[model samples]
Target: MKNTLPVTRYYGSKRKIINQIWEFIESENLEFDSTLDIFGGTGTFSYKAKIEGKEAHYSDIFKFNTLIGKALIQNNTHKITDAELNFVLTKDDNFNYKFFIKEIFSDIYYLEHENELIDIMVQNINRLKNYYSKYIAYYALFQTCLIKRPFNTFHRKNLNLRTNDVERQFGNKVTWEKSIEDLFRKFCIEANSYIFNNNRKNTATKSSALSCTKTADLIYIDPPYVSEKGSHVDYHSRYHFLEALVNYETFKDYVNFEKLNHEVKLGKTLEFESKTSISNDISSLIQKYNNKIIVFSYRNKGIPSIKELKNIFIENNMCCRICLIKTHSYALNKSNKALGEYLFIAKPKK
Candidate 1:
């Protein structure tokens, strides 16, 4: 079974051990009525919640993630007809969907003649939308497709999903167009029944993970383990679209990228940039909500000792229990492991 939402090249996506995640949640017998993934990367937790029939809430500081979340979790699913495809892809008929290509490829000026090729891709995607959901179907191949651009992220950015660009990349005299196309077709055939077939839920915007404040029976947090490390998440650079999403309409202050610099200046954003501090705020939240179970995912990287967490929880009338999760080795050095993730389960006494 092709998981409609198979793992892609996400850096910290939980898709790696979704089963393990499910085990933790199910084993704890967490209330299925409400759940939250404050550090929703791939949003596997929230995604899983929706799949399992839970009222789920997820938030991330990244807008790129939010865009994907909106499309995958929020948007009302549309059957995606062949007519839309015809409108988007085939220019021969009345509808010339060239603008669609322009929107996504507005930044693709460097590659030689790549702009023209993007137009072709736009057409192809439009025509193909009928075969699958526009969100998952189009990008299944395009997003991960080997395109031989400068960064070499794809190994080859020129080739897209089909047609031919093998010559443009490594000059390999191989025609992978057919092979990739076949895989895409197969993926779409199976993906159609899984994700696209299901009704999507609503995803809110400009909200923090704890913003849903109406205490869930359980709350899961995987905030950045350190204050200095959050800098690694230059969300504006990584997910610039988020700046556009928030309507700080009156506030010219850049809310995404430029805002990071501001956060640095204001000290609201940290040099390292995790939201673990939200846990401290939970001490405040406990005044209103009662009998809350909290689970937090943490790594040894600069985390306060478990004692610190214990103190925080205790002060808030919660009991904190820590469980060892996994230790991952560095990619370059298999024997080296500087950190491991810890699961902190806290039950509120208040």
Candidate 2:
């Protein structure tokens, strides 16, 4: 199958293992009329499900990711038209655009000129008439921001890494120096290529995994990874700029002024990111979706051990199986030994 899904540089994305996941689903006969991707990061899994002719539902707490889901998964017929793209590229003189990114984000993430361009492009995107068109534009903008940043993350204020004349062993200075207008147009074309109709009504929601009231025949869970050493992968901190971009109306309130990078002080906490609470969180999810087949993706080095997770499945009266995939070293900690990617498949006892 052609991997037509838009590529995302999101950490812990399942893009590489999606084919293996499909193999597991087929081998286990876990085919379903409908499927839900709870953590829907990058919406790759949901997009894969849609490609397979299933009713796909995607949910994420982050507005940026949910917008990706809306653009690629939920939105079937709507696409960015040539005229719409032309409009997004054009600046309107009538409407006064907000300079929030330019004013507050100076010297933090992008060059001064790049920041100004983002401010202008986002304002143009807001003027789009169709909701899907807006999402498509946002999707492009988000990808463009990520591509220009070092490590493709906003974990630190490292604009100097891109601009400084220091000898750099790493980093793509050329891509970073590329004009935001050009990058935006490039990503818009990439995003436009992924939009299509699967004939079923797929939906995307912005909500926590446990809060989603929707049920499906299959539930795919790929929660945030917390290391056994107590380190947590906080998506909010890594992609706060994207969050700020989408929530520009209230961005200032969420930003942690005390921090150099201005990472968002998130209002809500994810239990899955806390080692003490992760086991319970996984158990709750299993119990809540007990009627549906559960497919979970985890790393060998994650906080909750494989044995504990399997016991949780058994305790929930479900038959469990595991598949191990040897993968490259994690991007965040390349020095660490390579880890196995584990996929836990569970189904109610017959």
Which candidate gets the maximum TM-score versus the true structure?
A: 2
Which window of ten consecutive residues has the lowest lDDT sum in model 1?
259-268
Return the lDDT, model 2, position 301: 68
Q: Model 2, stretches more than 4 Å misplaced?
A: 266-268, 329-335
lDDT of 1: 0.46
Tens-place lDDT per residue, model 2, 202-316, is 9998988878887789999998888887456588788888988888778878777788987776534765777789889989999999878998998876777888888999999
- TM-score list, all predictions: 0.60, 0.95
lDDT of 1 at 95: 46
lDDT of each: 0.46, 0.84
Highest lDDT against the true fold, candidate: 2
Cand. 2 Cα-lDDT? 0.84
Which lDDT tens digits does candidate 1 get at residues 255-311?
322332222111124322445554455444443333667776666654455566667
